[model samples]
Target: MSDVILLAPHDDVAVATRDLVPGESVTTGDGESDGNPTVVVVRDRVPRGHKVALRDLPLGSEVRKYGQVIGRTTRPVPAGSQVHVHNLEMPRMPDVPGASDAASDYAYATEHRELPVPEGERPTFLGYRRADGRVGTRNYVAIVTSVNCSASTARFVADQFRGRALAQFPHVDGVVALTHGSGCGLVPTSEGGRTLLRTLRGYAAHPNVGGVLVLGLGCEMLQVDALVAEAGIPADTLVRRLVIQETGGIRATVRAAVAEIEAMLPELDARRREVCDVSDLVLGLNCGGSDGYSGITANPALGVASDLLVAYGARSVLAETPEVYGAEHLLTRRAVSPEVGRRLIDRIAWWREYAAAGGGTLDNNPSPGNKAGGLTTILEKSLGAVAKAGSADLAAVYQYAEPIDTPGLGFMDTPGYDPVSVTGLVAGGATVVVFTTGRGSVLGCKPSPSIKVATNTAMYLRMHEDMDLNAGRIVDGTASLAEVGREIFDLVLAVASGRETVSEELDLGQDEFQPWLLGTVT
Candidate 1:
């Protein structure tokens, strides 16, 4: 076993594969590139999954990892020293001149050509086809709340069918009450209200939801009739509408809602999963509870799967705008057109102002857990996060909760919060979500199934019940990057075909439906 791993030839630091005591000599391991194989004496106690300086660095000198600038030295450091936030700091790089002002130096074309999926390996999964010509991976009965005041009533309605009540309808995945924190307090005509309405309508009209019963309080700013009208719910669609105020209160509303759902059960259960092409799939890429090994293992492997999805003519959506802070430039280079690239850059600028208004900065990331896992700066974290997108050309940029109509890889603007981010992805029409985490993140999106990939073997073994796949084997040499990636792609197809994931087995999606509440609450 090797003691250290160097990701790239020009990297000035190497990652510690295991704990190293001072005065011990370490050699480059098989896990990394073979450029820097010389042994270096340990000058400090370096923990596993952390970085160690391979050479001396002076103050303000840029440190390189993944062949990119992660940060700069805060003070002079000797060889073999452990690199971390205390010794390194994020570099404040000025925005590129005219990059956002116009399409200056924008090529609008690149070497981004699609590769062919092997003829024998073209895959398909069983799915439910909807009236709108969209396909869904899961068949669910959705109870949507029009306002926070009616959330409890909606949940109660869904709860009536909790146990063996839905066993008769095996085709139905589950009865889910999709609730949120905002709906009545905001200005209904404001940007925040419009955004909220868009999200609710998206979920109500989602193909995955076989039947919907919209629950509302009669006096909220957002009216149920308006949402239904804007969402274009057809008369033939299996949908019901009810207001608690009109239904005589919580008990009456729950009874009415249960009766309504019962009437729709047979219709929802009649819909069965049929074979669908890979092109019918739309994958949402997200990462949370990230750690040092995330970039080296799961992220890059997931990137391979993303590229494969793109090759199959499917859509892949990458999100978390703040998390992509420093690495937005790399994505811009892969933009399908100059306009798409500029849209991404503009989103970056918007995030800067957005963060400032909240009395925060983009660099205020890499939470305490991230720092403990050897990630020292948001620049470093962002660089790792972008690996999940692979090298596919970014075809479009979308605002939060906006519809995604493109067929290739695209970017959706979202905050770094996990639930909020996934919520936006689902609203954007992502049929399935693939999330990679180094520290265990057990998460699931209601309408879309989430497949969690673990970055390190240790965490995977510890949380086997919560994780779907072990990507950490790439770092341990048990599997190559492509091998694990293929496994993920296969698992995705299986899950889309009605297979249950860890989070699904635990019944973890209903409480995770969080919409991004943009603007003020009042």
Candidate 2:
């Protein structure tokens, strides 16, 4: 595809992915005009991955993408005006009581647009099917622990099973240390502590895990046996546990864990990749450090990928609730039913109160960096952030870190914190994650791998070592959305089948485990 032109007909602006010089002639639709469309230099010089207007419009007009209003036109837009925050407003109702009779009727006019799905194609991917009926895109042996006390030992155990030791085991994809801090801190009887242990148990018992070793500092509030008993996990030859206090501290624990892993290695590496059905894939979608162009390019393209995955009977999880603020109504409509939509709406309300309790407002978002990048309000950002899910039917809505039951397209209640948000998705059974960013967030998660998509070409080129795919290629005038979506889908399979992402190679998953803290410490 030589040129990728995106102009939602209602939108008066069109974005140019590459740098266009002053008075440099360019053509648009049908045939070339006698003269170049009058170009207004929005910035000192137009850069790659930025935007340009399609035609002039009156002030207060809207800028559309994904067939939704991302922002409102500010100045009287001239033909080919470089439209941005300086010349736009977030799509918010006039903050006045009954300002205009048409105001109440002004809902998302672009919400009803039909998405064009390519004809006659069976989009599919390579994956693995588990005994529990869950599908996995990756194979991993996880060294999980009940609490922080066993974290170091867990890491020690996984280090002994690195993929390079193929001489001993070849079928194994890799090993990860999945330890967290909640195993012993608070009351074991409290709902929070009990929930924490359950999460740990779920991870250990997850079908994607080829083998699991649960470690604990025996004297901790959460006993290793307590997790297995309550969670109903089977006690099998593959399930092993080491108690540091009983095993004689870290040294003894490490030795015990190593021995157990050595015994399981042969079996863990014996499973090979079989052609699993496409329905076995569950993709997790997230975005970080988003800019104005993020919604227009990277996020939506990823959404296209999400749609493809779901259309093939797989699953897609769109998360980060706080970021979805003003644009939530769009997702609510996609919810499987009114109840599902209402549940999501309720969560948004809770977040508003939650933010206020902390003396913050939802609209107070748009970090300084975001504003500098021409993003004015949370409404504008949400419109962009929501694009990563594509247009699949919303099948379910889950609570933070809650198990992702029932497939197809879904929404998981999660915070906007990248590390925490991603952790929740992984814990909820997502075997792979796709993270899109405009300002560039170097983030990753262990156990389940993440594919980073860069929203701007400059960031992608600068951070090439971190980003796996450049959705910005669409913005740079080099690729099409569908093409990049295919590349991302292929990479998901590669990473799932043993290929490492930038984060995995750099060991970026260790510090990314952050659980959402809903209440205060006493």
User: Could you give candidate 1's per-residue lDDT for residues 351-387 as a string of tens digits?
Assistant: 7877777897889999988888889999889999999
lDDT by residue for model 2 over 1-522, one digit each (tens)? 212245444444444556655555443443223333333444224444445665667888776654566677767876655666567766654332221322233232233324344577554555566666676665667777777888888888777766466455656667778877666657766756755765676677665677777788887877888876755343422687778889998888888888887788787666666766666777789998887678777888888778777766677899989889877878766766666776676677677767777897777777877765546667767888888888876778887767787768889888888887887888788888899988888898766778899988888899999999888777566888888887877787677666779987886775686665433223
Clashing pairs in 1: none
TM-score of each: 0.96, 0.82
Looking at model 1, residue 432 earns an lDDT score of 92
Provide the overall lDDT of each model, using Cα atoms, as 2-decimal numbers: 0.87, 0.71
Candidate 2 overall Cα lDDT vs. reference? 0.71
Distance (Å) between predicted and true CA of 91, model 2? Answer: 7.9
Q: Which ranges in model 1 have alpha carbons more than 4 Å from their true place?
A: 29-36, 95-111, 232-236
